[model samples]
Structure formats: C-alpha cells, structure tokens
Target chain A: MSSTAGSTLTHQETDLHLQGVINRPYQVVVWNDPVNLMSYVAWVFRSYFGHSKEKARELMLQVHHRGKAVVSSGAREKMERHVTAMHNYGLQATLEEAE
Target chain B: MARAFRATTRGYKADLESHERRLLSQLCADVITMLETRGKQLTGDDAPAGTDAEDDYAHFRRELAGLGDQIDGSDAAGGLAPPDDAALARLLPDASSDPQEAAQFRRLSESSLRESKLADLRAARMALEGEPVSLTEEQAPVFGRALNDVRLTLASRLGVEDEADAEQIHQMAKAGSAATTEALMAELYAFSTWLQETLFSAMLDVMPEDD
Candidate 1:
C-alpha cells in the first residue's frame, strides 16, 4: 500500500483548515503608557467606546495598575479597527492572536 | 370695585435657594449640550477643516453614539454612579461650600448629558460674543495649570477659553505623541465646540437674564 499518511492529496481539506485558521478570533489590547494621563485614557475609553465616566475611570485605573488591559476582543478585522482607533487617540494599543 | 386678591403660588419660584438650584440645573443642561461636541472632536478620525458648526454637530451625534461603547469598555468612564436614594440622603451640600461653586461642579459633572442643544447654545453664544472657548478635559496637573492660564487669559480677553486657538491649550494632552496636522486640526475644532457649552453653562450660572 502507498504511504497515504505522508502524502497530502486533498486540496479541499487543506483549504478548509487554512480558512479556519485565518478566521480565528483576535484580541485588541491597550497598553499602559507614561505619557497619556489616566483621565485621558479614561476619556478615550469614554469617547471611543461610549462608556460612562465611572466605567471609563475604572478601566483607566485597571490599565494604570495592571500594566495593560484588553480593552476589547473580537474578530481580527474588528480588533484591527479598534487598534487603529486607539492609535488615533494616541494610546499604546495593539492587537495579537488570542491565546 | 376691586379685583379679588388671589395668592399666586408655585412652591419655589421666589425661593432664592430653589432658584439657585434651578440655575444650576439649567446651566448643567446647557454645558452638557455644548461641550459634548468638542469632547467628540478630540478623537474623531476625520480631517479638521471638514468640520464646521453643522458638520461638527453631525459628527457629535455619531461620537456620542459611542457613549455606550465607552461606558462598556471602561469602568472608569462611568465615574461615580448616581447615588442611591439612601446615599443621596447623606449627600447634602456642606455649609462651608459655596452653593454657586457647587452648582458649577455639578454642571461640569453632568456636562456629557444633552449634547446637540448644548452645541447650538455654544454657537449662539460664540456669535454673540465674537469669540470661542476650549472645552477639552484636563490632563496632568501641569496641564490643568496651563488650562487655568488659558482660562484666565480668555476670561480677561473674551470671557472664555477658546479651543479654536490651538496654541493656547497646546500641551493639555499630556500623553499621545505629536499628532498630524489634520488630526490636530480636527481635535482643535472638536475642543472649541466643547468650550462653547462649558463657558455658556458657567456664564448662565452667573449671568442673570435681562428682564
């Protein structure tokens, strides 16, 4: 018998796996920075996310004390948009593969 | 013949204390309407020159739409929650604090409430005064000091800090890197619109309406 396990032949199967991998969820993370004020960070959250002042302040404090916070998480495209917004707002924001 | 005398009564109309409270409530509403737009401009992705009274307004609506998102995203955004009835009972103003100043702070805290009306109020007020104001939220203590300087200058010159002049509130944003010209302009426009509400609210508290 031919070594079927060693030889990959199903193109459709490979494509399916690739698609699934590409569709995996991504995370949007806002890192704590020295420059932006805690209040400003809260404002960004309030301004960008429509958060209440108390909620925004709590998140800001979380980021301030926690070193970083995952401000959002979702589809890669959505995470990318969030990251771009954070950048626009001058936050040290980033996106990465969610573990 | 004489008209029958009737006691006209609306519980609190003539009460100086209630009028002061009313003044604060009105001012709070006005400031929220005006400054909310400027606060929006601070982080808008659009180009600056594109904004005007109308466009800033439309964008303000869009930005405020994200208010829920902001609140959901950060606990801090909500700030102090409204006091529960029990908590509120214990929250009477201290005898030492000036009622007017307390009114101003209440207006400031409520500044995010009704945005569009506030924006209109701002535009009208600015046209009447022929100047502008800066409504940007303070950053660092130093920036607050700078804002005070700008605020003092504006009060002396035109009676309010004008965000239209970016040079004045230059370093108010302590964190963020240098923004592109377009980004900076957009921020400036937003902030100026924000100023309209803030100053108007403060003014309303102090500026009694003409009879």
Candidate 2:
C-alpha cells in the first residue's frame, strides 16, 4: 500500500514538471526601429513599464545596439498585452516563446 | 506671437492667437483624415483590385489562413492587415514576429487603436475650436498623444533617423531656408516636436516630485 502511495506522489510530481515544461514563459521583445527616437523609446520604457530611468536607458541601448531586447517576460497572455501596448506607443515589438 | 503650453489649476492651458488655433485645428483635421484613410486601406476595401496595396492584403490574408496550426483558435480575429507606408507602419507596428500572431494582434486591436488616436486628434481639435484652448486633465493626455502621432508622421516623412540627422535639419530650418521640401518638413517637425515637448513639460509640472 505504501509503495502504491509513493508511486502516486511521484506521478503527480512528474505531471507538474511536464506542465511547467509545456507552459514555458513568454517574453515581450521590443525591436529597434529607425523611426522611433531613442529618447522616446527610453521614455516609453520608463513611463509605460515604470522602469527606472537608468534601467530604461539600459534596455533602450540594448535594443538600439542588438536590434532587439526582451523587455518583459511572463505568461503568454500578459506578454501579448505588453506587445500590443508597445505597438500602440509606436514602438516595434513582438512576443517570443522564452528560451 | 509666442504661445506656450502651461499647466493650470484646471488642467493644461495653451494661449494661442486665433490664426494659430485655426492652423492647429486644420492640422489635427488632416491627421484624422490620414488615419481614417489608413484604417480603410487596412480592411482591403480602399485599394483597387490589382494594386500593390490589395496584393499586400491578399498576402496577409493567405498568411492568416495558414496560421491555424500555429496560433490558438480564440486569438484569430480577422481584421485588417499591416500598412505598407513607412509612416503607418511606424504608427502601427506588428506585435508579433510571426505573421500569424501579428495578424491576430492587429485584428483584435487595430481598430480600437486607430479609434483611440482619432479620439485624441478630435479632442485636441475640439479644444482648439473653443475660445480658450485648454485641455482638461483627461484631455491633456489625448492632446499629448495626438501631438506625438503628428510628430512621428512628420519625422518619418522627413527621414529624421537619428539625433544627428534631426540636428542637421534643425540647423537648416534655423538658417531660414524654405527653398527645399526637406527644409520645410524639418521646420514643421521641429515645430511639432517643440509643441509636444511643451505639453509634456506642462504635464510634468503637475506630477509629484517623486515621479
């Protein structure tokens, strides 16, 4: 009986692990575009996402230099909403399945 | 006449002469018209049958049709596609790398997004149309967004890619050369940027110090 209970607990743990694997977090990536000003991008990061000015500048520089930067990561729905908001603010953005 | 925007106890206030107000109203009206035209074009109706615009829409539709395997069924809304124009593309960027996901994002949000911009433009126009061009607290953000959109459009058209480019344009404008289209656009871009900055500063004045 004890052996059966232990096996059941192990199965539940495996199920949870599989669920975690299947539901990996999604990331919102802001892509650098020539049209948007660097100052404007930093301001959007600071104001919209409420990041610190320094942090915003760091992220903006990442985007400018690397062509893109993952600004936030979370559940797929939240990431989608973030991408949409970024679009509304005239910034190029996308969602990616997190690595 | 030098007119600057300032934050008032009531909201944000800008003192402008009648002609200046009239010109601003006209500009807002023009932007609204442009946004509406773009919105129609997105739905694949405004473009003629065999034009590039229509072709682009067809491609988008085909991409969307093939997206069933990638995206969830509930995310597909089937609205307009992305714009081909650089200015419109800047204003409404794709929200996803995947064409299917981007199309779904556009379908679900583009109309409302366009409407919000239109609403902002309208609010600014209405405020200017009044005797006193003052924006309420709620209306201030709308005006600010409208100004930003106008500036974005102008900057895109002027090809102001970076600070250096914008600075050169500013110098050209300051030299008082309206002889070229680039010079004229630069002047307009500078004016719009100044106006937007003024409004933003006014809003900043009203914010808490900690912010």
Q: Which ten residues in a row have the lowest lDDT in candidate 1 chain B?
A: B87-96
In angstroms, give how far residue B88 of model 2 lies from its true place.
Answer: 1.0
Tens digit per residue, CA lDDT, model 2, B88-149: 77777777667766777777787788887788888888888865678887787677677777
Tell me the alpha-carbon RMSD of every candidate. 21.5, 6.7
- The top-ranked prediction according to TM-score is 2
Tens digit per residue, CA lDDT, model 1, B146-189: 22222222222231222333333344333324376444433332
Residue B102 of candidate 1: its Cα lDDT? 27
CA displacement after TM-score superposition, residue B191 of candidate 1 (Å): 16
Error of 1 at B12 (Å): 30
| TM-score of every prediction relative to native | 0.31, 0.74
Shift in Å, residue B39, candidate 2: 2.7
Worst 10 residues of 2 chain B by lDDT: B67-76
lDDT of each: 0.40, 0.72
Docking class of 1: incorrect
